[model samples]
Target: MPAHLSYDVVIVGGGHNGLVAAAYLARAGRSVLVLERLGNTGGAAVSARPFEGVDARLSRYSYLVSLLPRKIVRELGLRFAVRKRTVSSYTPLGDGGLLVGEGRTRASLAVLTGGEREYAAWRDFYGMTRRAAERIFPILTEPLLTRDELRAHLDDATAWRTLFEEPIGVAVEERFRHDLVRGVVLTDALIGTFADAHDPSLVQNRCFLYHVIGGGTGDWDVPVGGMGALTDALADTARSAGAEIVTGHEATRVDTDGATAEVAFRTPGGPAVDPTDGTVTARHVLVNASPQALADLLGEERPPAAEGAQLKVNMLLRRLPRLRDASVDPREAFAGTFHVAEGYEQLATAYQEAAAGRLPTAPPSEIYCHSLTDPSILGPDLAGSGHHTLTLFGLHTPARLFAEDNDAVRARLLAATLDQLDQRLAEPIADCLALDAHGRPCVEARTPLDLERDLRLPGGHIFHRDLAFPYATEETGRWGVETAHANVLLCGAGAVRGGGVSGVPGHNAAMAVLGR
Candidate 1:
């Protein structure tokens, strides 16, 4: 006989979002079951020891934490904590670079551009975004607002126009005169999103809005114990609230009318998944997987493919690489975002090249050293021996570029990317790499295709799909997480206003169930 179970709600995919929904619903006296295809939960938000015999635990896929709400943290009593980054970012020019954060941003700006005009514009622009963040972030958990209602919430007409009305590139161009400053501002609109700065679709605008409004202050912080710590806390909260979590259960199908649902699954090496034996019935079903996966489960025709656009490289450096700029310390520079080859013209040229199906001559990328903020992720030996972890995320290298030969393309792309970074550093990054126990260099690169196969992110898109506005659309209900079937809800990154590490989708889905 195949294993069978029943619950008030069955969640397919035990990612952090699913765990959040499970915790909230279970706390409200609802019976919940979370099925995860992987042996462990947390999904992309996980930490792993990639290098052999390395004591360092790196936040593998999703690194920073900014979008998680304090309401969920308090309601669930999660023991998660995050540390503020001292430096905001560092973009290298020739001998001097533009440094942001730690009270020296103005000085750095003045030094680089030889004036305070850029700094003044920077303050005005960011102040606008900060105000917009305060107004827009609080409503993410409540019932979705219509576009007009959202505009009313954000009463500033100029702020609204800058973020929503015209292309984000227009605002960037009109606000800042320096090409470096303009490129730095435009980078936010392109992280994990493949789009031209002035794409008519306004996709870049949507992406820019999400990045700035995170946490109501637009500050992305380092998680205290890596990204896994947050999910671990959520899983604990859900379990304590009487939720059942089953790992290695791949959800195969969901048959549901408007009122009730039955979920079919198959475990690794298990018999064929059919409703007869390997099935569980539930009054409600919440899919915490990608939108494409959700369509497959509901047995609907798959939607258009959403392709991811980025390159991820993780390295265990024996020590931080020295920078070409001798004035700034490596620790301060690497603590925040270390941008390379991302000048405004460079970014535009790269996009044009990539759009034409060729790798950019100079790929734009950012690097972050997580251990500088929280050294606890390192073991005693590694922490004391000056070892640190570096995470590099490359832009403009979309998933389509790796379709023919992922390995060969990845190698060619990695070399070109490192070559770009090498220009900003005094020495090549390769010399600073620590060797694993197997004597291999402690560096690994993951293309979007690697992410697709590993994490089931449809087309390896990090947001699961292109993000939608937080407001209610015609296809959705009062809650952005709603689906066509009343009994089914989407609780994944694919939901509207549901990208990043935020549990907004999960929280909104739970509130929709609770009729809040």
Candidate 2:
């Protein structure tokens, strides 16, 4: 609700990406305005005390950070930081397990496989990906690189063949022999994607690359003070740079004629703008929403809807659950990704079962503790009492499986998923749950359908759509943010190199506008 009708740029969706664009554009002296439909900014990257009177702030959605660039943090001088977990992951296998960090990774792998071959193979495979990350992560911020250009720049024919030319399953099969090890490696490819190991379409490969290339080390870091800390910092930076961000205003439609455009929005309770009623005009329209939402806003034909394939559960634990694998401490296992029934065969079976329109009999998931790395999210009272937060991410639970009856399917799947986790625990996780002020358990489960209802994510697809390779396609304009309209750009996770918590698309959109 600004009286001014014309502005330099009008951004839709005040998510993290939109805040990045707003901060960059405003710092460059552009009159920028951001419209958000939610009551607060940060979109999915916010932290909330979801449990009543819990005295703990949990990252409600999109927890953890791996892809966010340090360049953005430095450029904006945002007061946000991340803490690294000492352990990378722990995969329970009967009485033994595989722990991948803290100088015991090789020994743990040896125990799991009964040999050192798997450990060597793991080292070699990750070494290749580490190099690829170093070379490929830089391209995300620059202009779009064509497929051939990127392949040649990588300079590793083997890495290209393993990652780009063939399915990730091929590489997983060729590089690793153990079923549990293979599943551990392949889980990254299926985080938010609904694809098989050998899906010829190679969506899993793109997802895998994004996951491994984060921070040039593939290590997912915990955002200090929760994920909302980063978005809050970005919002503060944008505001200080003179960008006006208006929450509770939804951009309904956009009418543009290439050079200049008018953005129409719905304001629940605010005075209208001048000269054009509820419309605001700008030289460029940068949409920080999904691609499907952009097409709808532009009144164009919508693309195929994307389906999300993950189940998220957030829980507050009075104490960490005891593990059946006594060789590893519960603290060490929960500190990193705790693999639950995610063996390679189990994952394949789950994917096939879900593809055939049923929930996986043995659901595959991974759990990690957020408060283990940063106890500050819990106040003095909660932290002093040994309280912790656990986030469980279930795989292969696609949106279609719950289309018939979301609540019923969610309940069934939640029970099955927790059962799988309990198999590896000495005691039930439910027994370790903390109670909120209402005397209810401090645990909540969200299916893909629930995400759509809450976040406006089309079909609950977290990336907004299937992630594309970080290369130029036929539709990829100069910066990979451009649309058919010269003045329109995508600044959200829907952009070509966009996904996860990364702000590449937003930075690229601003760069395109600056002609840099």
Candidate 3:
């Protein structure tokens, strides 16, 4: 063992959240050290050029920015840039598609539903959610509120009952009569959560709340230079604040005594060659790993099972696929999220199939053209050549489906998912795919198991674990990031009000350490 190094605070996992916490603590003149297992930081929020001889940068795992709090962005003075999509989403139906955007939503819905009733319902339903978002989003930055306190803060019994008390499926079903419209509303509930829309456990409700209330606006924007830009900005902010960052260092164990916490880590190469280990003792320890990872580090029993239920696919396309509906331009349809077989019944069927340990015959997925909104992701040569990038997020494909024969399962799932996507396109999507210098198509799919192996996410749970209600539970007056140990705190997506790229947990963890 080497000599014990000490710091005022030590953050495990150099994800955006950990970096955020380190920046805040270090800015306050507290000595801080950040340990990251990967060669670079960013965790899931990373952008990479996966294809050989390809200039397109893809946001590999987690894409889009919705849940990031603006308060943190402003306070940190980070230089991250995100571009808002002019089109929100475009879901294809029989011959036309349902288009949802900022200024043109009503007209588009009227055209899709072919009537004013469903359009009126859409307006009313979103109106309620907007009001709910206004009331709920502000509370996420504060200390955890009790259930009753949150309800009281909402101040509307109907809004509370619809959003908090009942399953979100109930609200979706009651509000919309059209299956496609209903599915559009329910997709938010099922994004990273592996629960039925009607799950009585209200897991879907919790997911829905985060999706809608992100940044106090339900807009999911694309980071200009790819997701890595956000993390890079965060890293620069932390370094500017005088925080020490050590990459390729994995925290093996965390021991907390009454007075302080100690973190043992293996540097760069494992213990085989580098037999000696390093230790950092700190007054406060902020963990950005999943709860399961934390439990393992603490040598405690595992927490509840966490399994991510989404398959991510990234592809570089030679050109945008032609839409079945020629009336709408391919650029317009692909600019926002393009839904493939994600209707209400279709999503439910896929969920049922996946739950039964079978891949959905027609996977419910959505695709977005990153280059359509921001051309900076591609090299000037590629952009001039009309090349584009597509990111597909397949829902209801849980981690369990890929448990055995991961490659075979991924192949089958990818084929089926692309087939479903092709159904909506005028030409086969594969035909539009670009080729790398090695003559292989520029495409990659990541299953939950792959995510676990690559990103060290337990069971590939994206939010670290299932997202909890932003407010407090029975743990009274406790900060959301507080763990059972006094010196140790969860500053990752597993913490309360934690999830997405918000960095709320990191902020809260630093506040806890500051005794605020």
Rank the models by lDDT, top first: 2, 1, 3
* Steric clash pairs (candidate 2): none
What is the per-residue lDDT of model 2 for residues 263-346, given as tens digits with 9 covering 90 to 100?
998877647753333889999999999889999999999989989999999999999999899988999999999999999999
- The numbered model that scores best in lDDT is 2
Q: Per-residue lDDT for 321-430 in model 3, tens only?
A: 88888767889888998988989998899889989999998899988988988899899999999999999999998899888899999999999999988888889988
By lDDT, the better pick of 1 and 3 is 1
Tell how far residue 134 is off in model 1, in angstroms: 0.4
lDDT per residue as tens, model 1, 1-516: 223477888989999999999999999999999999898999999989999898989999999988899999999999999999999999999877989996988999898888999999999999999999999999898898899999999999999899988999999999899989999999999999999999988888889999999899999999998999999999999999999998887889999978889898877763665333288899889999888999999889888999999999999999999999999999999999999988899999999999999999999999999999999899999999999999999999999899999999999999999999989999999999999998999999999999999999988899999988788878878888888899899999999889899999999888888889
What is candidate 2's CA lDDT for residue 84? Answer: 94
Q: By lDDT, is 1 or 2 better?
A: 2
* Worst 10 contiguous positions by lDDT, candidate 2: 268-277
Candidate 1 regions exceeding 4 Å error are 1-4, 270-277
Q: Count the backbone clashes (under 3 Å) in each candidate.
A: 0, 0, 0
- lDDT for every model? 0.92, 0.93, 0.88
